[model samples]
Target chain A: MRLKCPANFRIVRLPCTGKIDVIHILRAFEKGADGVYVVGCMEGDCHFKSGNFRARKRVEQAAKILDKIGVGGERVKMFNLSSGEGPLFAQYSIEMDKKIKELGPNPVKVALQAKKKAA
Target chain B: MIIASKKPIEEIIQEVKDYKRLLILGCNECVTVCEAGGKKEVEVLASALRMHFIKEGNEKKIDEKTLERQCDHEYLEEIRGIVDNYDAILSLACGVGVQFTAEKYHSTPLIPGVNTCFLGANEQRGMWTERCQACGSCILARTGGICPISRCAKRVMNGPCGGSSKGKCEINKELDCAWQLIVDRLRDLGRLDDYEIVAPIKDWSTERAGGPRKVVREDVQV
Candidate 1:
């Protein structure tokens, strides 16, 4: 089925959100993702038992790390939803897209662009 | 193991912001297991620093290096060949490793990336509780393996101080009174009589009270 989400929304699926490490989120920001959000299984419903729980904690840590790096923690988020929640997934995508639009391009990318222009 | 927690990224950034070339040093032993100064942490911190500098429109040459164990002179010497390339070193080891690294490279600035918290056991993932204080004494055999020096709020040898109620320390209700734990353990081991014996005054001279100390074994000398 087609994902009814914004064209700019890029989805990288993980077998379980627990596989999403802090480095992954940090790298996304470093690689110019204006915003990054993890959609994990609903609380206590993870197929991998505690994958969602672990993912939530890692996301919280990644958000803090982002905040420390001057990126503002709001740029990274974690959401819990089951696999059957197709509409919710669409909603989250739209919500994240709007959030990024408000935040504008990632500051890191903006700086790189400015540097390129000057060169 | 030596427990540690990462320093606030904001504080770390502030400390090394002026340095263009910085090395993020990680330790592979205790810090790695504690999830503080491990190899993976080096990557996370380095990535965060690089991202921050990119956003600030500054050129930052952040490098990563993970030594087998930063507290050893042999491991620290491995960086000598490349130590001159960086303006600063961000050590993610325990405080011991940071000091040792600094001592080895006296001219280079070595900043601690983690706050060395305690000698403790990881109760579970992400949770650590102090287990030993290195008081230079081992009384576990007589104390039924419950250490008052480290677990006790007051470090009283004969205790369950008047302040202890319901097996908890009065200082903090959450803390289990060290004496209480010792009594229970001794009772379970059928050695309740041991609890009645008063422990002699500890020799504090062997502890930090004696100032910096060292052990040089002539038999082990090469």
Candidate 2:
């Protein structure tokens, strides 16, 4: 099947969504990702039984941490979809791309760019 | 174990906002089990603080460390060499750990990151409830191993107060009456006759009423 997503769109796969931790999501932002989203198995359908559920909780917690640091929590999100949902994955990519576009470049990235120019 | 919860991020931010270099210290004992002040929590907090400072357009350095146990002086000494490098120490331990850390490092300011809740048992994952008050008294044997001092809201010894109804305490309908539990346990143990003997007034001196307390074992003294 031909996969279609924005050229800039990046996907980081994991053995299971539960393997995705808060630090991974935050590090993406620290390293200048405008946004990060986790695609996990549908609720209760996780092969690991509760991996997706755990991923959702970690996403929510990571968002709160972002909000506490003046970074809008909406930049990160978790979406549930089965492995066969290729079209849905593209749709989520489009949706996230649009949201990130509206939010513009990540402030951390902008700050780094400015620092580079100053030095 | 000692139960605790993290303070609001805003409160922690306010405490360390003026400092450029800060250490986020955690304890691996009770706070770790409670998910309040463990290594994982330290990473989260350090990242949040860094993000906050970045958002404020300020350069800050936040370090993270988790001691084996913060309340013990030996564990605290591990940071003695590096303590002077930071402006302040943010302790994620219980109140005891915070106080001990502060007392040991008198020159550096110590900030508490968690509000020590109580001496309780972990009912389950993410759930804790108070169990012991450390009143320096143990009446569990006479009361069928049910501690009225900690379990009962009123700490009644002779019998349940008039507010007890259908085995529930008056303070909260959901709370089981301590005396009622004692009576039932006594029946199960075939010691219901012990309930007939009324307990006398407890001596508060054994507890905090005698001011700060300590236990010195002369035999163990070096």
Candidate 3:
């Protein structure tokens, strides 16, 4: 159960959230992530100005791909928060927990296909 | 880049059901970029197949590795010792990559995980659109840089035929007439008269019809 917690997310902290790329997100899902959500700095508040903007776009692209391949793109999400938004961070986790609960286990796990080679 | 789609999970599982030993191969090239085949995809596929077998009361062992470029000889050579370990190889690369994998490992069965599609461009993030046919010739420069062979339904080099309607192709209402794009581009460059030149019926002699083509560059020789 601990593995499925929002805290189980192996956070790859970046100097700025803008450094996160969509490839990373897709790779995460491919690694069996039940869901992925990028926490980025609030707009107009990014320390790197436009870095957060690029991160947002990357997350969106990853989400679209996840959607296309029947992985439920909603499983991949993005949230904007400031460095000191403790309450918001907690809220995001709680919301993620609920969303994962709704999604249940990963589809790949549920759709495990077995081989039937001759004995 | 060429785009391909992975077969349905059930379909792939069914296709490989008869194999007792399987080697799941991944490619780090085109299919990887298109989100079809890659290290991560191989993991997911392996995990899914394993789970399926266990669920059906039959357990099996599946091995996996990502080749740098299976189409290249050196990379294929890297897997030599273990190639004989598996009865069948599941290739998660494009068609060319799969063919090369089979060529190098003649005794093992090679199965493709992806349905190779046409050459395309990522028009938007996660969205791919076909843009080229590789008809073995070049005509874009004369048609205002838009590929008539690929963009036009009829591959017409003389501009829109009677099928063109209101700057759109009659075949596909959503498609903008390729000739319309050509004329518009020519007009923008103040060279609309360039469209007046009728191209001669293409000499198929220089293309694939001529024979298998090869490029030998002395400077790039190994």
- Highest lDDT among the candidates is held by which one? 1
TM-score of each: 0.95, 0.96, 0.68
After superposing candidate 2, which stretches have Cα over 4 Å from the reference? none
DockQ of all predictions against the true structure, Cα-based: 0.86, 0.63, 0.10
Expressed as tens digits, the lDDT of each residue in A1-119 for candidate 2 is 78778878677889999998898888888888999999999898999999999999999999998887778799999999988999999989989999999988877777667767888
Report the Cα lDDT for residue A16, model 2. Answer: 99
Chain A TM-score of each candidate structure, as shown: 0.94, 0.95, 0.83
Q: What is the lDDT of residue B143 in candidate 1?
A: 93
Cα lDDT, model 1, residue A53: 91
lDDT of 2 by residue, B136-177 (tens): 978888999888988999878788889889999999999999
**DockQ (model 3, Cα):** 0.10
Q: Choose 1 or 3, whichever is better by DockQ.
A: 1
Give candidate 1 misplaced runs (Cα > 4 Å).
A1-3
TM-score-better candidate, 1 vs 3: 1
lDDT of 1 by residue, B76-184 (tens): 9899999999999999999899999999999999899999999999999889999998988799999999899999988888887799899999989998888988999
> Which residue pairs come into collision in candidate 3?
A112-B52, A113-B52, A114-B52, A114-B53
User: Weakest 10 consecutive residues, lDDT, candidate 1 chain B?
Assistant: B152-161
Cα distance off (Å), candidate 2, residue B7:
0.5
Error of 1 at B17 (Å): 1.4
